[model samples]
Target: MAKSAKTKTEVVAETPVPKKTRKKTEPVEDLTIAEAPIQLQAVENYSRFSEFDIYLFKSGKHFKLYEKLGSHVAEYKGVIGTYFAVWAPNAHYVSVIGNFNGWERGSHPLSSRWDGSGIWEGFVPNIGRGEVYKYFIKSMNNGLELEKSDPFALWCEVAPQTASVVWDTWYEWQDEGWMRNRRKHNSLTSPISVYEVHLASWMRDPDNPERFLNYREIADSLVPYVKEMGFTHVELMPIMEAPYPPSWGYQITGYFSCASRMGNPQDLMYLIERLHLEDIGVYMDWVPSHFPGDAHGLYNFDGTHLYEHADPRKGYHPDWKSYIFNYGRNEVRSFLVSNAVFWMDRYHTDGLRVDAVASMLYLDYSRKHGEWIPNEFGGRENLEAISLMKEMNEAVFKDFPDAQTIAEESTAFPGVSRPTYLGGLGFGMKWMMGWMNDTLKYFEKDPMFRRWHQDQITFSLVYAFSENFMLPLSHDEVVYGKGSLIGKMPGDEWQRFANLRLLFTYMYTHPGTKLLFMGGEFAQAREWNFQQSLDWHLLNQAPHKGIQECVKALNSALRNQPALHDYNFSPEGFEWIDSQDRDNCIVAYSRKGLNPSDTIVVVLNMTPVPQQGYRIGVPSVGIWEEVFNSDNPSFYGSGVSNTQVIETQPEKWHNQPQSVVLTLPPLAGIILKKSAK
Candidate 1:
């Protein structure tokens, strides 16, 4: 009875043997379908996909296609083997080609389903997981033949080798406590300070810089470091398989495959599990906007623009030199949405930060006049893409209610973060690109001229509450000739470090969740390089070390202080105490929690000149103490600070009931909390 083949429940409920501990899996020895004891079956009686599955896939509602469309190891009758299925509607003939058959085409072919769903599926006996394979497809339209990787593969060969590996998403997860209570951690009002990391370059082996750290190795170091840094979450730059390293994982070739450069599917799961065990959430960047035109990728599958649009004006991305998905197509939408859900379901990712959302929403993104086509409504909006996003977000929230879907949208599209029922796009949060741009531009200018640019810094507050926002100082700011965050500061070394510290202080106290790129926390002095590790040696220097300490303190405050997070998405959480002090290059604001007693005041001195006895408004009549100061000597700032608690007098200032006189340090930020009597 073929050793009493394992049931589907048994296969998935238990962990797959790890690569290191399992017996070596090699190409089938001198085996071909014609010479084997068992033959391929046109699986109908033992088919994994049913009629309803095909209907759902054709109608673009099959969000769980991974369970049916991919190569799954199973037993047919009493023989153990693997079942393979793929979607190539334009293909006249399709066959499985791999090392098992000496890479010979037509040795074993798949059968097209009778349902007219354009799906090809079959079960080949005597073969199981760990087999490397690709599909040999002959186009029905042009007779064009090509080999393509599986779109629903769970794992692919490490980049530089374009072949899919038969694998399973089985792992013994130990994050029950985290899974049960992640709703509060991922809530809109919770503290969500994300540390964006590019896995390849974040750290590399010291002895062999060329070798990438496997997922388990990364978990050993990343979990402890993030826990110590006090970041609530770690946002990984896309870990999906992409051939070109320079694309930084945005150019995905395998939608459902884990980047084999790191490790197998289980290895990546272990990394996420480690983070969740430490109470830290994981957010993966998902790219549905476009894909690279690699030979084996989704560009021209089945010798037709089946995955992308037929028209170059609608299909191609000029800026990125890639192909945009045909979001209007039902099957293509099913594929994209299924990929999004696959990660969250199989990998236990806490959220998906959808990338290049602005490009997806606009038909004329980066195109000149006469180079683009308008939507049916004669507008620039890509209605099809918008609908796909709404559907994707709805499916994600429906299945995983505690999970979040963030958007990296740059344009001022109305309600990018609002719910779909309210005529919005239905994302959990949108990147505050305007705030990131204006804040950087204002900080780049000399503090002497910041008075004239006061409006630039405060303008974000005007539309702050329009959507649930996440203030991002992301990887985009430190790459492609844009200098490092600290390098953008305009001053001597001492003043530059102070400005960086001040930037973090103001960002934490701002009215939004925060996201900072990897190296920015310690003030790396150079632009980001994907090929190498961060400048970790900079920590030995006092100024760089101080910047790290300041960021750690800021993250601690963001996580522990309810006033900083409770109303981050609402106007009730933030109130301007004194924004009209631009002459002194000063601004003060109050952040409040649900309870009025948890109010905290923030003040910033943009210039490198101290002001003693600077009066600021207070919301309560009590002694207010300095809770945090960026000017502390430990952060490499001038030691000017308010050393004692100051009693608020019964004076009306800045529309507040009480006021207090305080010392303002040069080029620094300070937080004041009223003490309980």
Candidate 2:
């Protein structure tokens, strides 16, 4: 219920707080009004925007809109009040509404900027931190009235309560060391073992299964576990505020606000700060492709489809039943780009993994013929989206040189991870979806049939270095009736775990960065359910413990072994030693670094039968020892390993000058490193 009557605007001025007493997080509501009050119109004498800001915002170059557009707590003319700004050009009238004003629409109307930027702004006294509010907009078109959440809100009320909150980003960050030297950790050449997690489901209140652990609680548990597990970075699933938990944070309503269900903005910052302190980088999953069509969200914003396209073909997403963004619009581009930059700028995120990129790149993605409109050039490419992506990437890298942008692009779009100056999309990395699909397909088959389909495993190297790639066994593979990674294997319990270990070893040794979904590391038996926590009880079993230990070892090897990561994205870093061993259901390769002494050989045995005295080619004539064997007893593997270091012979095997004879364990992968000459 709201008051329908319009009221004349008014503002009250009071003595300013001492500069020394002012703090960003100080609640403005605590201030006492002066006895002799000075009253003025609510929309008069206060503005946070400058002429240049309007110019940039109009021309779509304003990437830091978070500073200009959101509701910011400020002291105006010696009085503490909140400054509100929103872009709703189609609205004839816009007013602030919330509990503070008794949901009165016309009591606090904002004035349009004189610069024709379509930005409505004003200052309201006594509206301070923690006040819930929404824009009550009367659209010029058909006098349509809408109550919409602020797109640039720094915080929002929890789900089932959609009003935006007046808040500030103030946190004492203790991650200076991490921020100063993050380049090395987030470098393309570094060993980036990302553990992708859905925060709500990663772990919950053990005492109450229905409750989600807040950001601080998650930090206490997740930080140490990831540190001990040896992952270099943590890629959190979309954390933006979404009304429905089933959407899993993807259907973002508050683009700039962290999900209120988790905690406030500072709470999330604390979690990220703790991670950085632990030397772990954070990657946020960003979704600029489509948004859920909620009434209070961007859809039909201002009752004019302001944030989305006017046409159904270009504006709607068929697959996800969401509304696509109007990338062609300048203001929308500025809003989207600003949202991307805000995370890195304010949240100190190390990277952005752009989600559903392929869906954004093509004009007819998931649509049949005649259902999509071609670009002006009569091409199927989404030219506007392409341009927006380039601008977004340029802004992200230009502002934060150490940060990276990774694309979850499935199609063969050229130069997705290349530089924008070279007609590329300018991402630092792209997920290798082909590799994940092929590897999983090969592993799910009976070992006897794998030899016939050797190309399924070897096909990835054909384009491994085409663009910077990250092999991802993500959560998508284990949801919606899809079985768990372990359950995907075709074998008894022991063999299934063995296959998962071998799969992980292959991924780490492969020529790319690595990403593993939460439950995959330990082989959680059931499919992922966003509603419940992972089966932590599964760790009590020996096999599950074995898989977890195997992943830890793989991460260690990926980090410590230079040969595995130094040239991971370069052809010079890899060589095929025995790809034609289809008869033996085995594939072997060598990894090289700057120094020849840093070379390592990897061999994978796909079958259950051990190969006694298997001869694999070596790059150098020296003593080579089994540095890591997946079949070790520690990982619950059948105890089979080459305990002795062997000197290579001038055997001219597999086109190499020298070779070594070693015992290959059944259904396992092993790493060999040459000893110092």
Candidate 3:
């Protein structure tokens, strides 16, 4: 077994581990699969859990703890009620308070099991779904009374209203074909062009202005658009229920519930089903880093920092004004790991992009030198969170091999996307923040000054394959004063549009998967506003419309061209033809598939000056066709293009025996494939 993150000194439980602690996890063998997740519908006396169940939970290896702990509706003795269980170790007393009992605590007092598991449970007969409820707890530590929302809530009330609704997983899914063949779409070599979106702001009723579309509506609108643009996946920003809107769903309150602002859990399921049917995979942006310290949320339970740390330095997140989970605790790991699998098993989600992973990996993230604590090894790494991430990934992958877990980590943490058994974090992919930063820095510079800093663009290939990287120009780059991507270009109107086209061209041809935030495909001039809809009217203009058309073409080519997507993670797929040509600010490269005949040469001119008869090398001395041109009139460029074919010369150049003279358009990228004989 791997080392647990709980330090030898800190004991989260009220009592220390017993003699069975040193023994292997043999207690869990006592419980059978029959005891797991069967909903009841009668007056149930299922008030106590077996010691074996609690033992497995205490070991932090029980992946299905959600079914045993949270509210589960069932029929027992012909009485239908919801079974409620909670972990509040420090509380002297706990009760379920809700509208069913007129918010009275005495109506549904819970009993503490005698097993020392620190769990309380009770069943209420004749009460079922849609009832608002909260846990009223009297703290043994301070006598402070607290009423908190359910941590495992399935459906929460809309923002500004705090209540947990009893929801049933009752969606009839029609995505069996998608679920069966998902491996073909989620493979490392598959073309994964993700369109990132925030549901609330993605669109609103044009006439009403303040009304956001629900899940079903988005399926009708967002689904077709993604399919038409040829994107293979759609990565949604967090849809978890939150009290604050500007937090953009990051300040999570209900870790288990989908945001009710969009509709019920079933409606969200419908949206996912539609997407899967269309062959578009769905990835949820899952936040397991920190949660806001809202009064009704997970800040304090049992009034003793049950979910977080008592120490401010360890528990508090200064950047987001939230509280970090005490990952060293066994139950906390079970909660997080169970939540990850819940989405994959219950909703058929293709992947989870773990958000704010850098903050979770390091102990001193965003803190002053003296304000943070080190791990047991006296290092900055937070071993507990590392263990939790590994378990989450391991659990998700073990059951659903077609699913994936991606990391949004920014630091140089080694082996972030590697398998866990190899002494690494078990993640499927990681965002390429360095590439996004370097590429944007190069593009934002003036064309005249860009040649002086040509290394900025070429430096990314140095460690591009360090992980299974996904090149993301995500929502983070478009909001909070960073400005829209097109707005950051250092040029006039026409030049900026041209630069934007060139940037997308380079992004698609780069050696990684792709993700673009909403509105970027159409060149929305305004920055993203969570409160408002995307500026969809921009499509009426020629420049913005042209950018949209170019993106469509790029996505189509990225999916169909095996040479581009076949060897995405291997460095052998890419070879530079002429990267040292800083004088004219032009970079040329070739991409290869498994077969030598599958080859495409890409050339880019960063400046506004066109170059005619610029010689570029090729592997074979044959005709090269201009397959794609960013300078085409469809993209609103200068229209300097090669409409005809050119034969390669026998003269040697750029480490290749055959070369071809080409017309390189200004501020453009062109793709030329070997002619089909």
Position 409, candidate 2: lDDT: 99
Please give each candidate's TM-score: 0.94, 0.94, 0.93
Alpha-carbon runs more than 4 Å astray in model 3: 1-44
Candidate 3, residue 674: how far the Cα is off, in Å: 0.4
Candidate 1 clashes between residue pairs 3 or more apart in a chain or in different chains: none
Q: In candidate 1, how many Å is residue 202 off? A: 0.5
In candidate 2, list every pair of residues with a backbone clash.
Answer: 10-42
lDDT of 2 by residue, 1-677 (tens): 00111121232112121111111232223224212232222433577677888888888899999988979877776778898999988877778877777676666788766666888887888777777888988787877778889999988888787888888786778899999999999998899999999999999999999999999999999999999999999999999999999999899999999998888888899999999999999999999999998889999998888888989899999998999999989889999999999999899999999999999999999999999999999999999999999999999999999999999999999999999999999999999999999999999999989999999999999999999999999999999988999999878888998898899999999999999999999999999999999999999999999999999999999999999889869999999999988999999999998788889999999998899999988888889988899998889999899987788998989989999999999899999998875
What lDDT tens digits, residue by residue, belong to model 1 across residues 284-348?
99999999999988989989998999899999999899999999999899999999999999899
Say what the RMSD of model 1 is.
6.9
Report how far off residue 231 is in candidate 1 (Å). 0.2
**Tens digits of lDDT, candidate 3, 1-677:** 00221221122233321111111111111224223343454443555356688998788887777677767777766777888888887877777877677676555767666656778777777776666777887787898788888898887767676867766666678999999999999999999899999999999977888998889998999999999999999998998898899999898999889988888777899999999999999999999998988888988878988788778788999998889999999988888898899888888999999999999999999999999999998999999999999889889999999887889999999999889998879999999999999999999999999889999999988999889999999999999999999999878998999999999999999999999999999998988999999999999999999999999999998998888999998898999899999999999999999888889999999999999989988889889998889988988888898876789999999999899999999999999998988
What's the lDDT of the predicted structure labeled candidate 3?
Answer: 0.86
